[model samples]
Target chain A: MSAVGGGFGRCDAPRATARLEALTPFDRAGRRATESHASSRQLAGRTATITQDTSANPGDLFYLDLHTHSTDGSDDAGATVEGYLRWITGRRRFGYRIDGFVLTEHRRFDADRDYTALAEQYGVTVLRGIEVETDVGHVLVYGVAPGFYRDFDVTNVSLPYEDVFRAAREHGGIAVGAHAGRPRIGLAEHVDRRSVSVEGVGIVEALNGGSSDEENSHALHFAEEHGLKAVGGSDSHFVSGIARCLTAFPEPVHSVEALVEALLSHEYRPVAVEETHDDEEIRERSRRLQAVRSTAEAVHHEGGEVEYDHSVIGVEVEIGSAEITHEQIAAYCESTGDTNPLYRDEAAAEAGPFGGLVAPPGLLSALVQGRGPDPKVQYGNTTFMSGQRMEYVAPVRPGDTITGYASVKEVYEKTGRSGRMVFVVNRTRYANQRGEDVSANESSMVHRQVAPRKES
Target chain B: MSDAITQRYFEDVWPGDEYIEEHQPTGDDVAEYLHINQMGRRAQTGNLDGRFTDVAGAARQGLARPIVPGAMSMALITRLVTDWMGPLGHLRSIEVSFRRPVQHDDRLRANALVTDASDEDGEPTATLDVFFENERGERPVQGTAVVVLPRRTQPAPVVE
Candidate 1:
């Protein structure tokens, strides 16, 4: 059983010593884990504890879970907005202090009716925002009004992609690509030359609640290549899920204005829980991969450049009809920390001009596309997602078994600031259970040659 | 009724004085807690990579340093007060908030105070304030509580 104590400095003698003795082993193990994951300890290295007194000071560092959701917008059945507020306020019988939280719901819902009053009541800073799921990818628009783009039809609108980007910028909002990589949901199509030249987006999601290390690495590479600010989020729908992933800013930001300024200034780093691994063990596994035969075949070869038109590269598969549940959408949003109401609340969606519940554009991107039971791709080499360019055609309603098909369009090599990199482009088309095209996304990937000495 | 103490009764009193208790949280404790709660089980089940680093990375970023759940702190405080006041002590209220991030290797000390005690409607109740601090003397958790304790039984003086 764990021991107990008083409010502040009640017990200073035996209790203090006993506490130290009990903590020694845990402290040692934590140190070892921190040491093992040294290379990826960017956020851990910058950790500075914030106290209530220190938070009053302007320069004190604070960690903010920039992306969060609540039951008010999304279909988070387990937690209410009040529960979330109390959980973070450290005022409940069992609570914890969160510097602040941004109330980002889907554009389909009203933030004022659902979250604003609660924020005021709780005395916690709430940044009004939305996670716009566009054709290209999910973009987090912070510091915007609750209904800023309520009338905009993200899927069918003919406005240029830049117009939407500018809309966020005009609203003093930061546009961040949500989950740049993680197989189904990332924006791997936006990095194409045509898309990059046209969109000019500025932030990338480096850590997502639902992504793995490999997915995070893809996001990291995108941030590095595009010179964009990196952000992280738990994408929580359940109250307990908040703060899973956070951005530790160099200073405290207690308001929407300050949050926007922090993002604009690039003053934060992504921090998650640390992992433990031994060097030699990982090295041994890499050594084993060296024995696998290369499946390289050249369709065209020229001056130090070989183009492989591998016959098996463009395999097309159909994804059959499947039900779209609110739980699935909520889970996806929670994983990404997007709380857009169009995906969560049925009444709000019905009351909307669209007159129905609509999936967040991000969820559309996340849903698997491919026909048949065996549609998995065995990708060789690093799958570095460059960007996404999406065009939403229709609203994907619940109980719709969306059909999807994917085909590889091109593969090529280019030399950039990071030396020679290979780019592979894939196009995916989505249709409703009725066999109508609802959206299409073109995804791009870049594989860099890992120098032998620098291999992970 | 004054001499009878039940678990429910023990949870009902609130004290006014301050007190503290310290605890040590272990890695196994963390592992068990997460396993039971399934906080980040989805990521763990999806990623089959054998490296503990991968598991920890996913769990940490997904659930705040992969330590015990914050709710567990409340459960501990309830147990402490109940054990001290015996079965007749009833916990009336408990309010705790996390002050600092609690990691795997940190030792936690819970301090509490019984500030008020009185007889109401033939029952004795106490109000208390409490909090939990880490090894560095940082308050990772804080709250106020109230409990009702049983009084000693007395013979009828008039009849004697």
Candidate 2:
């Protein structure tokens, strides 16, 4: 609710919500009213009907990123629901008021995977929607209901756009053409060349974060000429890109039902997140990333010979031992956010095949000693753990005394794109009090030679 | 109590099956993990390169915050596999490659895709491709895991 300029102002919430329902759809009366609005809104000459009243109350305009993807549902999306929330919270510090974002995952909707708890924790309203491929282009469907899926196979890559548009309205949702100016998929190209006209299609994404300025311009003009209403979305597959463009509504939207109702009100507009003067946070993040990368790069510098004690390659020695306890097992689960009942719930464990609470396979790192006999490899200026392989022979339970025996498995040199590097492989075996081997681990470390300095 | 303790039989699984679980590590969680692994001593010894303990240390290394240890990242993936396999399945082997640093407070999703499931050499086993994907959609940690599970019908016990 922060000010972007003198243009936005907060109004009484109860009055705005009441007025919005009168202007939207829900019950019999609202639907009848909306049918008229929907029909008039669809006309290609309804441009003059759009309200440009400066006297309209701003209310609490909810700014929501209408399109986003997440790894939980979208295969190509890199952002998580929580990641977006955290980034949004960070943005709020800079006075950018991003109320929420919709998860418009590609091709599917997991109705059971709810984000209510996460939304409450972050104080951000989370809603679910879907983006499906069609003959015309990709379409963003908000407020998807179960009945909609029954009518259309949304997973179909080549769904008929005409049916999708009608079906969305029938199911209490809205379908907006996504990235409307992009090539091949956008509605603009189809309308211009193929004379493709989608009846009942009303809204198109006018400001997509992923779309180029020229592409967005094309979509804006397309909407103007077609007399289509518009919404905005980030179309963001990543965290930072979220809310770059969003739909600003006149009333607060807390659910899919409210979102649909508000869109039908035709009082919302696409708005970009205005940049603030105190955006040092974003700059600092990139700076840190650069630092981490450069530090890593310096370790991969070229030109050095590998040296190590050859005799210690196969020498085995006892490293250390620790008694596994139930308390330790519980603490490990808590630290890792592991909610597996078999590890924490004794009653559940007793009913299972194990017949008792067993430590997680990962707990071996804590039980087994970290340091083993050094391979004494003298090579590079940088050393790091490259990889680890572990084999569990048996389950380790509480009251088991675990002991680790270690040895230098091997030391070898390899050349990669980076340069010459020496790798030391260390092997460790964990045993119970009865001296039975429970697991074995092989960890490899890489030593990279320092790069030769440049002549300045 | 978690609802993930259900039993999974060897015969019920298939190749190409995928399981995803999310884990968000707080700064305290990372600190405790390093402490439990006895790596906290590095913090006391002034060896902090801003890797996994504090913010000031992270800033010195050009990091916005402390990072989760690679070992902890591996542990999270292990939990993902175990949670999916349930109590009946036994984890036989896991090999992981630490591809990138996972910063503290980063939300991660562990993904496991079953590559092969078969009864080989009288033992039923499943091979899975597992990875830890950060919010940035990058697989910072990934590898393969082999698990052993009990068949629904046991073969006749050795009569020797």
Candidate 3:
């Protein structure tokens, strides 16, 4: 309560005098009596009263990290549930307060298997959720029961998108279209007149970490066109990745219920990417390379004809010479809500046939950008992300600042119901600090040029 | 008159009615309502002192100033009917739609009119029209209710 009190202050001389003059003796007496009541009673009454306040106040602002992962699932640096909780609560202990966090693992893991139990053990409010990687797009379903994910078969269930969206809503959670415009099987490909007909969904991710300028812009345009609340995330995989794109509201989020209400009411604003970091240039260049690499990768994988230096290119390319440290991988996994220990569990990785820690396929793409893109230019887009098609040619261990270089292998154009689209093929070569090609990625993206109609 | 009665019901009643119950909502009520309902605070939590100051200002604007939840009004209507009809009577149906914004510090009344009564399976069923209006003669919620009443000879259950 530094300069910010519990949203109250003593009136200045004139206002105080006016208020005193306006009060009758009975009113003054009653006020005194009320003030003289016990402190506990006052606190209880205040708590009850604040619940009904409909106007913005300084005390009403609350913060939550809706997406987080542990090392219990796939594609992570092997940080345990407790380790993740310690990292998060440690921030609060050091004075950065967060209301709560949603543990959203990928489709392969169940939140209840380890995360929820550990959260309960730590006395933290953790919502059980899943970040489903559909063939068409990525969707984050929050506040859902543990068994719900199982009901929707990750492999075989061709459940209508509406059914999945409705199920998430019925269980007292929200279904957000995550990273809508990224190169893979994104929401733009899955969503149409049929998908839009599903009601009760009002949120969309307008920004994601590692997103390209074009992809982000597409996301923003989509959110605006559909009249939805735009959300943003770092899609971080590490502790440093927290707050990449924070949602700010007025404060004192007393419970998870209030937090949900805040989101549903659209009483929040997405913290732009540019506003997130201190270093502008580092983020900007990193973002550009991310776009270029992802674009080029998409082209080669889509079977498009791209004649480039494939012999010189390795399986994966590290953009800048940053060590592929164990710490970096672990942090990346945590921030992005990945919980698989194969990356973090050195013992497990060695015991397995791979004989060493292997990075998740998605991590291959994410790690290429390293820290994140320039935050300023990062604003304005709603994000829709898809799973990556990564091949682990070799083991990537700790203390490896893998240098990655990517080339646009080819470019093509196609026409769909959406409109004219351009596809870019990207091939990336990865090497250790020694500059040896360790892994490679061939990815493709189909960019739609036509802008979506704005909805009022 | 019967048509009006048919259109409204006792169970569907709220506060702020014109011909039945009359009372003026105050600044304190508005503040209490907002605080309890968690409606307008932009911040995550509520502020007690701010509520006190703002609620008073809202009252001066002639609105319900601190309009309580419609559920609260429904509860009050239920209490009123329960008291008049006795404990053996069961509230069967209640339907209400908020027509206009109800603000803080507005004088309000709750009203009801019995329109239909019939005997079915030895039980008496009554239909009543209900309404809620402010001192300014505006209806905020209006609807109807159906209730099943026990025989007059049967004593209502007593709890010690």
Candidate 4:
């Protein structure tokens, strides 16, 4: 048995190998047609090059762009299904063999669009997928079929994020948090890593084309901390943005179903840029694509971008609750060296002022510390816990759960020795499951943009 | 009550100790699970020949008829070991591969054998190699689980 997770490499399934040997052979690159339901063409096409997994691990493998947008259904995309295939074919000239891309249209899966001819001609795979805007953030849903489009009103963006993930689970698909490191639409931005860690979302976008380097770094860190699977997606709405980020699966996956399995099994690695041609070309293309998007609005549905403005104040919402474990409390006390007998000993706590094994002050702050209800303030890329004040209302005894609710009580600008800092003042109320207010905290987060590497 | 397992402790378990358990999943149970979980989202619902699961839909897609959803089988297998672990047993990890399908009304048996006993993060943990098999003895699910068990002689501090 594996000690924990990770360190499991792919093996050449001997049965699969024997079956492949029984089929007719095709010329390398699958240019020549062979017998066996055109099956040999697929297996022989890439199986010989399995060791070239993006992570450079010798294993059964394939590569594909996990995120792409199309004008057929999305208002923000520049390309048709065929337009993308043509572009993918063009990339082959640059010696980048892109196997395929999942067309993540905003709010809809465009189940009717047929790309068989285009896919075959360009030797690329084009699968339909949905990019949903949930209450928390945007998630990418793959393997959405025709019935799903009609039944779920796939065009609707009002579905709650948790519902979207549950639906994806039911349907045998996964709802991966898209561009999780970015602001507003990203999962890591609004929801704390602790919440996202326990939730059904098992995958996150560690590398995204539109997000900055630091934003992607935040996503990578979040994924590592939570042991969540990290994928790199282009999030492309245009030609140049395609394949900006890719996932290399250990085994050659022929369809989107296989891709989903690879993601869930943690059998893939994120790959960014096989070859760096130029950024100016991509930026120019993005500008041109925006123009195309503007024109294509007539043919497609619009509106799916979440931007947080720090303009609102006194906005209260629920920050949800986390179930605490005995071990977690121990870890916290270990870090802070809180030896308060009243906090640890039940006998002492019973004698103390109206308390039975009350939680220490650090636990309350830790419960309230992570990002509260998103103040939607985007002052900088890095979020730092600047300061906090805790007022102990009651005690959270053992066997009690803590639920947190927060409001953006204040938002103000400050300029100290360290440049202009945006302080988002939040008031969080922590309550035990027993309807007792445990602690109330007012905290400030200093959001300051990190200096660029060259500038520093 | 027929398969009631004796409560076990960290010190009581030895490698290669085997246990067997069984569960029968019906179509109605699946319907309730789907409906209660609100899992009837577009991806996994529809054509209920009595709340037919994704396994039922798989037949139309050229797969076996009325095969059980992988998650459903996983839930069953997880319960098999968890029931034995009692309240103090904290399930750490369950890693399984779906080698085949388990259809509705297929009474399945979970076979578990203790693989190792060691300390993880200062806690006593046991690893078990678990497998689920049908009446035909064909294994559909097989994996390993790591669980932290409470010490029988000593008590842990209350820190909840």
Local distance difference test, each candidate: 0.46, 0.65, 0.43, 0.54
Which digits, one per residue and each the tens of the lDDT, describe model 2 over residues B1-160? 3443345556656543445555667777777776666632322343435458877665554445667777787787787677667667778888776645677767665666554567867778876667766655355666778887767786322210
- Best-to-worst order by TM-score is 2, 1, 4, 3
Candidates in order, TM-scores: namely 0.38, 0.48, 0.35, 0.37
* Per-residue C-alpha lDDT of model 4 across residues A179-239, encoded as one tens digit per residue: 7765545777556622533377788887776554545666777777678888877876545
Candidate 1: misplaced stretches above 4 Å? A1-59, A90-97, A114-117, A120-123, A145-151, A154-161, A189-198, A273-456, B1-160
Better TM-score candidate (1, 4): 1
Worst 10 residues of 3 chain A by lDDT: A41-50
Those runs of model 3 whose alpha carbons end farther than 4 Å from true positions after fitting are A1-60, A76-78, A89-97, A108-111, A114-125, A155-159, A189-200, A249-260, A272-456, B1-160
DockQ of 1: 0.02
Error (Å) of candidate 2 at residue A9 is 58
* lDDT by residue (tens digit), candidate 2, A208-280: 7666455566677788789988878887655555777788887789999999888788788876654211233
True contacts kept of each: 0.00, 0.25, 0.00, 0.00
The root-mean-square deviation over C-alpha atoms between each candidate and the true structure, in angstroms, is: 20.4, 20.5, 30.3, 23.6
Ranking by lDDT: 2, 4, 1, 3
Best by DockQ: 2
TM-score of chain B of each: 0.64, 0.84, 0.60, 0.80
Q: Summarize candidate 3's per-residue lDDT along A1-456 as a digit string, tens digits.
A: 001111001111110000112211222101110011011111100000001122223124454556555445534312244544544443333223344555566555453364456676665655545666543356777666555665676422123456667777776766777766554434543444224342545787666543444565566666666787866654434332343344556654434455556677757765432222223331222222112112211211122222323343233332454456666566554432233445677775565334567554334444453221111211112211111223345556676666667655544433222223344445666777666667665444444332222221
